[model samples]
Target: MEEQAKQKLKNYVLWLLSRQEYSRRDLTFKLQKKEASPEYIESLLDWCESLNYIDETRYCEGFIRRHLAKNHGYARIKSEAGAKGIDKTLLAFQIEEMEIDWFQLARTAYIKKFSNITDTPDYKQKAKIVRYLMYRGFNYEQIEFAYTHNQS
Candidate 1:
């Protein structure tokens, strides 16, 4: 009966992985929700890792790429990845490997949102734009560059 349960858990994990990537913690949480035995879940997770069926680094890279496509800055991406149980060192390494220009991405996001406003904005409008950019996860430096250079 225990063997049968383990097989069922393994099948479920395989099916989940086939559909999409999942971090180790994410998979563990899913199995726990199904009330699987903790020992069985741990053993299966180890097996999966040994076979490279679940890789945290690969998951981090995909997560970063998807968020980047949405124009999210480094701070937001890192925070999201961390929440997903990804390692900070691994995520930072992946972001560095991508060689992303955050300032450029900030400018692009600003332009995409404010393309219609051609004239210089008043003080209140400037404050609003800055707040918008900050909420989009850009740091002050990137936001400043985007605000000043995007107009020209």
Candidate 2:
């Protein structure tokens, strides 16, 4: 029965992995929620790690790629990835290695949201645009560049 329970947990983990990537922390939380023993879950996680089934680096890379495609900035991606149990240092390193064009992405996000407005915005409108960009994860410098460059 003990062996059967472990096999069941392993099979469930494999099925979940087949559907999507999960960080080790996320997987642990998930298995815990299923009422599995902590020691058993830890051992299973170790096995998964040994088999390369739950790699933090791989999960972080994929997460970054998906968020980048959505035009998210570094701050937003880092925040979201952290919530998803990714390590901040690893995420920062990956972002640096990728050499992402944050300015360009910010500009793209700006255009996508405010494409209809061709003329320079007034003070109130500029404030609104800045707020919107900020919420979308762009920094002040990037937001400034996006609006100023796009207006001209």
Most accurate candidate by lDDT = 2
Residues 22-56 of candidate 1: C-alpha lDDT, one tens digit per residue: 99999999999989988888989999999999998
Runs of candidate 1 with Cα error greater than 4 angstroms are: none
Judged by whole-model lDDT over C-alpha atoms, candidate 2 comes out at 0.90
Q: What's each prediction's TM-score?
A: 0.92, 0.94
Clashes of each: 0, 0
**Deviation in Å, model 1, residue 23 alpha carbon:** 0.4
RMSD list, candidates in order: 1.6, 1.5
In lDDT terms, how accurate is model 1? Answer: 0.88
